[model samples]
Target chain A: MISDTAVESDTAVETQRGLVEIYSTTKSFHGNTVLKDVSVCVKPGSVTALIGPSGSGKSTLLRCINGLEPIDSGVLKVNGEHVGVVERSDGFYSLNRKKRALQRVSVGLVFQHFNLFDNFTALENVAIAPMQVLKRSKSEAYETARSYLDRVGMLERADHYPSQLSGGQQQRVAIARCLAMKPDVLLFDEPTSALDPELVGEVLDVIRKVSASGKTMVLSTHEIGFARQIADQVVFLDEGRVCEAGPVEQVLDNPREARTQKFLERVFG
Target chain B: MAQHPADLMESINKPRITRKTKTEKTAWIVLAVVAVLIVHTLISNPNFEWATVGRYFFGFPVLKGLLLTIILTIVSMALGTLIGLVLAVLKIMNITPITILVDLYLTFFRGTPILVQLIFWFNIAALFPDLFLGIPFTDIGWGINVNAIMTPLVAAVIGLSLNEGAYTAENIRGGFLSVGKGQLEAADSLGFSEWTKITRIIIPQSLPTIIPATGNRLIGMFKETTLVSVLGVADLLQSVQLIYSRNYETIPLLIVACLWYLIITLALSYPQKKIEDRYSKHKNSGGKVTATTEGVKLG
Candidate 1:
């Protein structure tokens, strides 16, 4: 009876899908603030692109959403569940390691450098999290891993190690690794920035496929043109705060804020 | 068309050799002569007693001593590597008190001579005559004599294992340090548990760095086992000493010991090379890994 109730609550939580809401989130490293009072509402199935210059805290904000790094102050919620912290009547308490890992089930992060495990084949890389964390059967996980690899066009190179693959191929495998987990929201940190000029298109093409599939994705990117084409919402961050965020067209083309206009001129000019 | 063959050959140009090239050829000839002379002196020396060495090479006592040496090296290395792995992880974990404790252990064991440590362990009864096997600070306990339990062979194994653990810990720590920080961040971002991160990601990648150093240590440990002869334990060196003492053929027995050591080390080298090659195969071609991460900015 208790197990049945637990399953019911789990499904109930799944059904009540909510927007990813960041409420006045502040994050710092040592004495310096990387994200100061940053808040953004990402509706379900929307693709948001975070754009700014180097040290503009775009990556940090993406990291905060996935619970990879913690916020010093404020609540970050995904589908109405607090991320990385739990708030009580008295105060907020940080989640433990296991709880934080559980929170990560709702989100997946793809790194700019495609940090695939060097010793593992592309298939093993994708299958590991499912077998280890999700406790899925080996065959089941491998089947899911293979399907995701096929989706990313890495099925042919499934047995290749990361060192044996090109940067574009490795990044596609990395995307498959994230997709295999079946997370609700996907976060990409400069996914194509680390690729060679000719190779960038292959990775961006995969990301475009994922974007069109309507998965909630937040990507920090330097590619203004790609961002303009894909992102439903464009967030322009300067220093540690969000400068201007709205429809991608207005934020990227004609911005009201002087900082946003200046940044766009410098980047798109 | 009808010119003589010699005249035709002279018509074609010949490459010139400079004085520097002639000197380089002479240098190679001189090195070859020196190497051949050294080989000749060693092989042609009659006093080496090749007959006695061949007879005693597979002799019972010498074979027994060789077996003991092999066992000691294997056992001590296993113990040392296990302890070293634990110490390396503890140091990296940075638990202040435990890190300081491990530091003291490394300093004391690595700082002193291995021979001295062997002697110290052999006479450990002087420091603690009785060892209790019960709860600490409790009156209810059973005590046993330390001297009775500590044999010469046991003392040697303990000494070698403790000393090797200190060096192995540093090697392992260096291995872990050689792994890029981006690897750790990627594992963390994937939400792998700390245990999974270390076992799956960190240790596997650290193998290329760790395996070669470990192979060197294994070879050193094999030779270092001879130090146990100082304790009157009948290891390879001591067995040779016993045979020479009985027959007064000291140099021959010494030659026998050297030959055995050479054979064992040569045997070990093959597998070591195979292991190194296996781990390094995947690492040779990867382009620049992620650039050294930018330090987190501080106000």
Candidate 2:
């Protein structure tokens, strides 16, 4: 166990694997319903791919579970903790504005746009969150960041800005950025769809490596091949509903719903 | 060497790639005409009292005017920039009824003439001489010096700053918004608090926009500072006015102030334009592309 593996620190200790439970989650933006009666549980150490056409509520579902997008009516539980936005039935959310802010730190989301701070180099982007938000020591954060970056094959590009990297490289850094947080669940909102045709695979390789590491991941992706390869469960989304879902092979390849069948026929063709 | 006369002639007649814009051509032509008219007028007018114009520059009254103008410009521009920064933050946060009121304040100040605001603030003491700023529904009061605060220079700074603040707020808000809604989410997902996101993430990303907007404010503030002379701030323009009025050499005395303003504007224009170009460089094709962390690998 001590074969030049260095020391396990606080971040290694803070990783608490937990289950996510959702019941009848619904969300809307400015009176337009984006997700309705959507229910899905992302179990610990499983890859769940939320697949759908554009505006099919895949991203919205991910957004709602993390409390990034406020839901109209829903009960979402992450690590057995309710990720509720407004006043709770037991009055937990009504603590104050400061507490509400504290609640947002638990869920980690990797945006499709890579949203890496362009001004900060890739390493600083990963480094700042741990050092500041988690109050981790600078050396500790940097050490974890280096490991995360090395895992994503971005340890060399740490000093480069987001602007200087290719699309594939940026998303890899984004994965490292999220992994640095060591959250209960890591949500990916169309992580690979925005990438160039050629660059998608390189980023997908990093995600697959992450999958093999047993990190719980909920990805919204257009890369059907990657989903079939990695996702334990594939939820086919259409018209803001879970049209069909099961194992990746069952749902993506041989879907039950007519909408899903039609979607893949078009997508696969 | 091999009878390339036709090709050389074609290259010579090739339409200019970096052709002068309509505005550039117009500016050049207008400048040339104005220069010609000035030279022609000077040549024909032998009896013009040019020496009197030089004489007004040395007078004590004109010196006071010059001092006032410089002071007004410095004070108004400084106050305006600070007010603008505060207003920008307030506008970007959750919009309440009070925010709407602030929006209205911005619109009214930006819409109206600066001269009018200067006059109104200067004369506000006539409407409410007893001013107080303290907790509501309490006898404990804080009296304010109405006359001291209402001095023309003070009023000018207040008016310019308040009015300019609104525009600055819009500029700052624009910069904040340009950082993209997704960028804020990225910051939040990273566990950055609201203030941290704005200062560290949002502000840094929006700098390309903020820089040019602030530069615009710098130039606008410079010009708007002259408006304070309406309240007897003795800014450069007002100083020029007093001198030209006392003496009959109106054109040349006004030209002195004009030359100074021109020089200052020209000096600022190059750097401002350069900064604007630098911020916009990313938009051009040559620079490296930045993708949002949404898993997109933008070229």
Q: Candidate 2 residues B1-299, lDDT tens each?
A: 34568879788777867888999999999999999999998778755546655666556766666566556566666676677777877777676976887788888988888788889999989988879888889978898979767887778777877887778778878877876677788887676777777667766666667777788778777776777766777777787887667765678777667666777788889999987776677645323224222232111
Q: Compared with the true structure, what per-residue lDDT tens digits does model 1 show for residues B1-299?
A: 45568867686546776566888999999999999998898789988777888989889999999999999999999999998999998898777999999999999999999999999999999999999988888878899999998899999999999999999999999999988877777777677887877777777777778877899899999999999999998999999999999999898888888989999999999999986775565455452221111121101
Report DockQ per prediction, comma-separated: 0.24, 0.35
**Full-model lDDT for every candidate:** 0.87, 0.76
- TM-score of model 2 (CA atoms): 0.83
Once superposed on the true structure, which residue ranges of model 2 sit more than 4 Å away at CA? A1-17, A29-32, A86-97, A137-139, A252-266, B1-35, B46-48, B55-64, B132-142, B283-299
Name the lDDT value of residue A156 in candidate 2: 96
- Candidate 2 Cα RMSD after full superposition onto the native fold (Å): 7.1
What is the i-RMS of every prediction? 8.8, 6.3
lDDT of 1 by residue, A79-181 (tens): 7788888888998888888988877877889998998877678898898888777878888999999999999999999977787799999999999998888
Candidate closest to the true structure, highest lDDT: 1
- Candidate 1: clashing pairs of residues: none
Q: Quote the positional error of residue A220 for candidate 2 in Å.
A: 2.0
